[model samples]
Target: MRAGVCVILAMGALATMPWAAADCNPPMRPPANQRKFASQAVDSIIASYQPKFKDAQLGQIFANALPNTLDTTVFEHTTSGELAPDTFIITGDITAMWLRDSANQVAPYMRFVSQDSGLFSLISGLVRRQARQVLVDPYANAHQLEGSPPSPHTDDSTSTPAFAGTRVGAMGPTIFERKFEIDTLANFLHLSASFFAAAGKDQPTFGAPVNAAGQTWADAAELVIDTLRTQQASSEEEGGNPPYLFQRTTSQPTDSLQFGRGAPAARTGMIKTGFRPSDDAHTLPFNIPGNAYVVVALREAAAVLSALGRADTAASALALADEVNAGILAFGVVNHPGANGTVLAYEVDGYGNSYFMDDANLPSLLGIPVYGWTNTTDPLYMRTRALLLSKANPYYFSGSVGQGTGGPHDGLDRIWPMSMVARASTALSDQEVLSVLEQLKGSTACTGLMHESINKNSAGSYTRPWFAWANSFFGGLILDLAETRPHLIFA
Candidate 1:
C-alpha cells in the first residue's frame, strides 16, 4: 500500500501485539471450548457470553467478529520519547500505521470506552498521535511507528521500470509512505470528531486542554480544515495552490505516479488527491467518492468545531463540504450509455475526463452510503451502486463461490469483505440483510476469520486473513443486526 501517487489501501490481520499484552476489555465470559481462533484479546472477548445474546444460536459469531478486528491487529502501545501514548495501530500486514485503518480499527471499541479505562487512554493517545501525524504531513497516508525499522520503501528512486528522469529525495524521519490520497486526511478529521464525540459522551471533560495537552479537539479540527483549504486546487473557482512533490524509486509501475504527479486539475471545488483509496494513481484527480467523503467527514468536523467554540471554523468546513458536494453532483455525475438514467463517476479530472467505475475501497460508490454521504436509496447512489456491484464496474467480480468488487492492491477477482459488509449498511430488507450475513458466515474461509478479500471462485481461496478492519466492521454489522433484528441471528 506504500505509494508515491497511487494507493491501494492495505489488508491483512496479524498479531502485532500478543493477546497476553492486550489490557483492553478482556472477555467477560470463559471459553465454551479450548479451540481459539484468534489471539487472547479476542479470545477473552469471544469466550465471554453476552446474556442478552444467550438465546441466539450464532451469538458467539457476532461476539468474535468485532473483537477479531481489534485483537488480531493493532499494536496497543507506541511512544515517541516520554509521551508513551498507547496507540500505534498498524494495518494487518504492514508495519506502518494507516490513518484510514487505525481510525476504523479503534472505532468499534467506542461503545466500551466509558467503562474501559485502558481503551479510553488507548484511543485518546491515538487521537493525539494521529493529529500530530496530520500536522507533520497530511499528504502522507501512512507513518512510521516509534521503534520500528525503516520501511524497505524508504528510498526515493525512479519508480517506473523506464526509470525516466528519476529524482530521489531524503526520507522524512518518521514517514513510512507518503502517498497523497484525499481520504487519508478525511479519515483523520473524521476520527478526530468521532473520538471527541465518544469522549464527550463518556464525560464532558475528556478532551479539555488538561487532558489533551492544550490541544483541544477543536484545534485539531481547525488544522484539518485549514490544510484542506490550502490543498484546494480542485475548484475551478480557486487558483493554483502550494507546490507539493514526492518521488520514490522502484521497479513496479504502480509503486509511484508515472509522471511524479497527477494531471492538472480544473479546480471544481473538489479536493485534489494524488491517489485513490485503493492507493492507485487516479487518471483524474477529483475522486468522486473522495469528494463525497470529505462532505460527510466535514459534517462531523463542523459539529466538533462548533462544540469546541470554533464556530467560524465549523462554518467554513461546512461551506467547503457543501461546495464539494455540489461539485460531486455537478461534475462528478456523468452520463454513461447503456447504464441507468445517471450514475456517479468514480473520479472526475474537472477537465471533462471521468472514470466510470468504482474501486472496492471506502469512499467508493458502494461505500458512499456507508460513509453517510448519501442515502442508499438516493437514485444516483442506487444507480452507481448497481453498476459497481455488477460486471459493469471493471473491478466487480463473481464466480462459483462468492463475488464482490476487487482492487489491484489486493488481487483479481478477490472481493473485499469491506465491500460485502457495506452492502448490508444500505437500505436492505431484513431478509436481504440475512442473505448477506449468511454469505459472510461462509466467507470467513478456513481460519474462521475474515480475510481482506475472499476468493470469488473458491471459498477456500483468499488473501490477508488477519484484516482487523474487515472483522471489526463485519462484527459491527452483526451487532447492528442483533439490535434491529435479533431473530436473524437465530435463523
Candidate 2:
C-alpha cells in the first residue's frame, strides 16, 4: 500500500477521537518505542556536541543544557478546532503562518518522518495546508489561519480578509495577509519539493478533490515566477510601477523612493514586489536574499515539475533560476572594506550603492551555508561569514547572554536572533558550535523557550515570547548536530 494508505490504517484506531484537537501535551508516559526514539534524538544531539564541549567545565555546562518545551501556551491549529499550534511568531508580533518559518520549524523532524508515521502525518498535514494557502493567493507569504477578524493595529491593511470567497482548509478561518516575499515563497517551494522527493509521492492534494486548493498553489507559484520575470512592483496606490516603492505606514521608513521610480536595472530580478521578507516595502528592491531564495525555489520547482511529468514547466523554471542566479552574481557582489574583501551585500543598486548589513533571516550572508547555497569552507563564503558575525557588519551584536545577527524587522543594536544562532551552528566548527550553544542556553528568558529577538545588552528583555520559528530552529540545530557530529553530546 502507499504511504498515505498505510498512515491512515495506522491511525485507524485514533480516528474516532479528535486527534486534531489534542494539544501538544507532553508525551504522556510515551510508549517504549517513542521513548527509544527520543533517547536516540537526545543522544544524537549530545554526541554532536562532544567535539565542542570537551572542556571539563564547559562539558558539564553543556551537559546541563538540554532543550525543553519552552512554553506550551503556544499551540498550532492542526484542524478547524479551537486551538492554535504552539509555534513561534516572527518579530512583528503576529500569530500567523510564515511560509519560511513553517518549513524550517519542521525541518528537523524530516529525519524521523519515515520511521515515525505519526510524525510524518503531522508534517504532511502542514504541507498540504500550506499548498492550499498558496493556491488561495500565490502572492502572499504570511497568513492568519485562525479565522479571527482583523484588528485595527494591523500594519498592512491591503491584506485584510473579507468573509466572502476565502477557502478554509485543515486550519480554520485562515486568510492570506502578507504578500509575496521571494525568500518565504522559495522556502515553501523547497520544503514541498523536499517532502515530495523524500516521501516518493506526489502531493496528496495534487489531483485530489479539494476547494481549488491544488490549483491555487500551482497557479500561485506560476504567478510568482511570472512576477519575477516581469519585475512587477507596487500597485498605483503604493507608488505605481517599475522603480518600486516600499512604504510601511506604521514603522520606521527604510526607503525614500516613490515606490517605483528608482534605477531599473537594480530591480531586474525582483518579481511581483510588494513587501519584503521583513514585511516592509522595498524602495529600489533587487533584494539579495530574496533573489537568492528565488534562485533556490526555481531550481526546486524545476525538479518538482519534472517529477510530475511537466518537462516544459521544468525547463522554464530552470531557465528562470539561471537568469536570477546570473543577475545576482553580476550585480549583488561588491568589494567592501568591512568584509576585508568582496562579499555579498544585503541589497544592491545595479550601478553602485550596495547595503552592507545583514538581516536575521535565512539567505543572509550568515545563512549561505545553512541554506545549502554554498559549502561552509568556501573562501569567499568564509570571509563573508566572518564579517557578518563580527562588529564590522553593523547588524551583528553581542551581549552577556549571546551573540547573533539582527535586522530591520526588529531595531538597531538589538541582540541577535536565536534562529540565526541555530543556523550559524549548523555550519560552524565544533568550537564555534559550542560557543553558539552556550550563548543560546544563556539567552532564553523563559528557561529554554526561544524568543523573537533579545536585547543586545540584556538577555532579559526579549521581543516575543511565543515564537515557533526560534523553537523549531533550536530543534533543527540539535538534529543537525546529532546527524553531523555525534561526539558533541558526551565528549
Candidate 3:
C-alpha cells in the first residue's frame, strides 16, 4: 500500500522492462548481520538448494522466504536462568503472536529438530509458551507478547452470551484478539504433537508446569478438549445463544457477527465457530474444514497425552475425534449438483443448508488431504477439489497474473499465495507442483517474497508485504519440494 511497495509491484508486472527486471529480482533479503535469528540446519538446506533451482527468480524468492521468519520475526529466545527457556515469535508487521501463525511459522523446522539442539530449544520453547497462553484463555486466537500493549479488539463484549448455563470465561490483557476460532486450539495441539514426534523423546518433559498455579501441558490439552466439547452445542440447544459471543463496532460486515451471535446452527455434534481461520465471521455455523482439522488435532492431542502417560485423557480425545468425524460424514458431505457427485461442503447448518465455496485459508476444504482429514486420492475429495478449483467455487479466481483461492477477507479478484502453497503441497504429481511454482514465481511482483494476497490481474498490487507466516510457509514448501521432488526444483 505504500508508494515504494506499489512501485515495486508495478515493476514486477513488466517482465521485459529492463528497470523492472532489475528492480523486482535484485537480492531482497537483509544482510546476514541484520538477521534477527540464525539456524545452521535451515541455512544448510537453503545453501544446498539455491544452486539446484532451475528458475533463478524462484530460487531467489525461496532463499528470501525460507529464512524470512528467522531473519525478521524471532522476537525472544531466552535459553536459561528463567522459569523455563522459551521463545516468542511475532507475526510480520504485527507484534502479537497468533496461536496458528507462530506454530506454522516454525513447523517446517520440525524435521531438523534432532539435528540441532538450539533449534530444538527454540521450538520447544514455543510449545511451552503456547501451553501457557492456552491456559490463559483457550478461546482467544492470538496473544500479546509479554508486556506488550493491549489488543485493538479488547473492547469487544467477550463474556458468555445471554443463555449459556456456565461462563465461557473473560478475556485477559494478554489476549490480542478474542476471535473464537476452532483451528486456534487445533493448531496448538498440532504444534505439540509435531514437536513430540520430531523430538522422539519418551520422557514427559513438555508436561512440566508452565504456570504458578501448577498447570501442566496436559492440563492445557484438557482445557482445549473441554472448550471444543462445550462449543459443540447448537445455538437453539443453548436457548438461542451459544456460549461464546463477540461483538465489535466495525463497519466491515465480516468484522462483527450479527446481534453478537453468529448465524444459527442446530446441534450437529460438530463444534460451531464464531470465526474462520481467516478471522472472518462464518456465513454458516459449522465450518467443515475447521471440523476436519479438529478431528485430526484431537487425534494428535490423544497421541501427545498417551506419550505423556495420560491414558484417560488420551481416550477422551480419541472419543471426541470420532464423534466429530461422524458428524462431518453425516452432515458435511452432500450430493452436489454442481460437482455431479457426493462432495464435501465448505460450511453447513444442521437444517440442510451447505455453503459450497472454499476459502484460501489453511483449514480450507481444498486442504483436506494436506490436513490429513482424508487421503489425497479419496474419491469424494478429488471430486470436491475439482469443483473448488474451477469456476464452481466463487472464491476461485483466474486472471492475467495468476490464479488461486482468495476469500472475502481480502476482497474480490485477489489470489492468496498460501492457497497456492496448499495446492502445491497437496499436488499429486510433479507437473501440478511445477504449475503452482510458476504462478508463485510470477506473483511476487519482484519482491522475492510472498504476500498475503495479490491482485489476479496485476501481480504488483498486493497486501501485507511483511507477513511472516506466508513467507516462512512458502519457504517450507520449497524445502519439502527440494527433498521429495528435487526434479522439479532442479529443472
Candidate 4:
C-alpha cells in the first residue's frame, strides 16, 4: 500500500483511540490535531518499511522505530512568511539552510512524492523557497530573509552589516568580502532543476515580474550564470556599479574598492575570481569542487532549458558543461608527491600549486557521487575516495570512534561530519561503509540528534547540536541501508 494511505489509516486509529491516564508531573493529553498529525507522520515512515516486516513482533519494533527515525520536524519553520515548518534548517547551530543542505535534505524524499502528497508538498515548498533564495543572490553562499539586504564591506575592513545579525566576515584583507561562491550557486541550480525534473512540474507560484523584488530572484540567477561564464568580479575598474561589492566601515583601506572588489593579489584564474564552496576565501581560487559543481550545474541547466523549450540555451549550457568537465579532468586531477597516485586536488593554481584536502560539503571529494557528478566506481573517483578517507589526506582523521573526512572549516583533527559519513556510505560498501555507520551512530551527541562536527575521541564534543542537515542525512542513510541492505537489518 502507498505510504500516504497507510498514514491516513493510522491517523484514523489514533483519533478514535483514547490515551491511558497517567499520574506523571501534570498529566497531559496532546491536542487532538497534534496527536493525529504526529501519529500520521510516524505511520507514513513505517508504511514505507512495511514490506520488510511481516511478523507481528517485528511490526511492533518497526512501528516504534518510526518516532525515533523521523527527524522531519527539525525541518519545520514556525514564523510567518518563512519557509514551511517541515523544511529542514540546520538548527541553531548553523542558522541557515545552506543551498547544498536544503537540496540534500529533500533529495531522498523525492522517491516517495508520488506515493505521499503531503510529503511531496513539503518538499515542493522547500524547493520553491530555495529557488527564490537562489534568485536573490546566486553568488552568495548563504542568505538571510528577503526583507534584509547584505552588508557592504571591503578588502581591508573588518566591520560590515550583519546578515540577520550574524557576523559576515572572511579571512584575509585581499579576500575581504565573500565572493560569489560558484559551487553554492551551482548546487542551488542543480536542486532547482532536479525538483522540476523529479516532481514533473514547472516553476512554482512565483508571479509575473510586475514588481522589482518579484523580478529580482530570477534576474539574479541569470546574472550569476552570466557572470560565471564571463568571469566577472566585483571590480570598480570595469564600471563601478557592480552589484556584488561590499566595504567594511572599520579599517576600510584607502585603496579598497567599496562595492565588492577583492584585494589585488587574490585574483588568479577564471576560477580565482570567486570564493571557495566553504564560503571561505580561496587561497588559489581555481577550486576543484567549485569547478566540478559548475560542470554538474551546466548539465542540469541544459536539461532545465530544454524542458522550457529553449533549445539554443540548452545547447549552450551543455557545451559549457562539457568544457568544465574537460577542464576538471585536465587540471583538477593530479599526482600527489607523497601519495604516489593521482587524486583529485582540492584547489589548483593555474601555475601548478594544488591543495590536497577535502571539505565537508557537496562537490567535495566525498560528495562527488552523491551529487551525481561522477560514478562511484569510476577509476579516478575510486582512487580519490581512497585518498580522501585515509590519513594520506590531511583532513582525514581516525579516532577511537571512527575514521572519516574533516576540514579546516570546523577545526583541525576533527572526526568525520555525519553528512560525510552518510555520503561516503552512499558511495561505497564493505568495511568502510560499516565502519562509518558505526562511528556515526556513536557520534550523535544528544542521544540521537546528529551534530555538525564531532571530536575524534569523544562523541559528545560535537560542534552544532541543532543541525538538521546532518540529522536528515542520517535519516537518509538509514533509509538507504534499509533499501540496499535489508539483510543487515534482519541479521
Give Cα-based local distance difference scores for all models. Answer: 0.67, 0.55, 0.84, 0.54
Evaluated at residue 464, the lDDT of candidate 1 is 65
How many clashes does the backbone of model 2 have? 38
TM-score of every model? 0.82, 0.74, 0.94, 0.72
Summarize candidate 3's per-residue lDDT along 1-491 as a digit string, tens digits. Answer: 11122335453353443323655555776898998888899889888888888887788888888888889998888877443667888888888889999998998889998998878888888898999999998888888876777777777777764333655446788888888899999999999999999988663447667777888889999999999999888787777445677888877888788877789888888999999999999999899999999999999989889978889999999999999999999999998888777999999988899999999878899888877999888999999989999998999999876679999888889889999999998889888998999888877777788888888877778888888888888888888788788888886
lDDT of 4 by residue, 52-123 (tens): 643323333233323321233333533235333224333234434566656665555656666665655666
Query: Per-candidate RMSD vs. true structure?
Result: 7.6, 11.6, 2.6, 10.7
Clashing pairs in 3: 9-460
lDDT of 1 by residue, 144-183 (tens): 8756777666775322111344433535667787777889
Give the clash total for candidate 3: 1
Give the runs in model 4 whose Cα sits over 4 Å from its true position.
1-43, 46-95, 146-179, 202-221, 232-273, 419-423
lDDT measured at residue 111 in model 1 versus the true structure, 0 to 100: 65
Candidate topping TM-score: 3
Two-way TM-score contest, 3 vs 4, winner? 3
User: Which sequence of candidate numbers ranks them by TM-score, best first?
Assistant: 3, 1, 2, 4
**What is the per-residue lDDT of model 2 for residues 1-491, given as tens digits with 9 covering 90 to 100?**
00010111121222232222323112222244433113344345445664565443333323322322212212342433321111322322355567776677666556655565445545565566666666655555666644557632244323322355332222224543444466766876777677766666644523332243225345545655665665633233223322222233543454222332333444444443454556555544577767877777788877776767668767878888887788778777778877667887777656566777777766566776666666778877777777777877777886655577877667675665654563446455778776676566545532345567776555556666555556656666655565677676444
Better of 1 and 3 by lDDT: 3
